[model samples]
Target: MASNNTASALEKEQIFGLAEKEMEYRVELFNKLTHTCFNKCIEKKYKESELNMSENSCIDRCVSKYWQVTNLVGQLLGTNRPPV
Candidate 1:
């Protein structure tokens, strides 16, 4: 009984660890994707001029639009309930 309890606790800890690692990985991936997409969408002629008012505005719009699309797709997928 003691051994069984220990094994169950170990399994739970392992699952929790796996979930934490997965969340970290997802955060990293999101950061990378955001950075790459922002860079590609907003071209910079020079370092100093990269984020002038117009450029900042454009970047903001692009980011907003991207999030909107992502949310829409997520909703669609959630409703469809695709096999996991």
Candidate 2:
């Protein structure tokens, strides 16, 4: 029926809208994380083409700690469903 079709179309549109929002949120979060870790772990000057061992370790630790804190806050808020 036309009504059913209209409802189905609306439902799909909403689902797609939600998916788009999730993607945007993820991209924004990634950008923030990258900026934070790079600033904290790497020097302001670009002295090397590749990260040194210490720089690599610092980034790893920074990301690990970021996620740990994220998880903790998520748990505290009861929103700690596994990542989508």
Candidate 3:
């Protein structure tokens, strides 16, 4: 039926809209995290243009801890269920 089709189309559109928004939010969060962690963990500048071992370790830990906290906050907020 035309009415059913319309309803279905609207539902799909809403789902896609939410997905788009979520993707945008994730990208923004990743950018923020990258900038914040990089600034916090990498203080030295070198001509080699490569992260030293300590810097690499600090960055890894920083990103991991950031996501851990993010996930915890998300859980507390009861926003979108945590991934399986």
Candidate 3 residue-wise lDDT, 20-78, digit = tens: 98888878888888998989998756646788888899999999988888888879889
Worst 10 residues of 1 by lDDT: 75-84
**Which candidate number would show the highest TM-score if scored against the true structure?**
2
For residues 1-84, write the lDDT of model 1, one tens digit per residue. 999999999999999999997788668757865785678666655767446776778667876766666667767888432111
Clashing pairs in 2: none
Pairs clashing in candidate 1?
A: none
* Per-candidate clashes, comma-separated: 0, 0, 0
Quote the RMSD, in angstroms, for model 1: 4.3
Q: TM-scores, in order shown?
A: 0.58, 0.90, 0.83
| Overall lDDT per candidate, in order of appearance | 0.70, 0.85, 0.84
Task: Report the error of model 3 at residue 14, Å.
Answer: 0.5
Top candidate, metric lDDT: 2
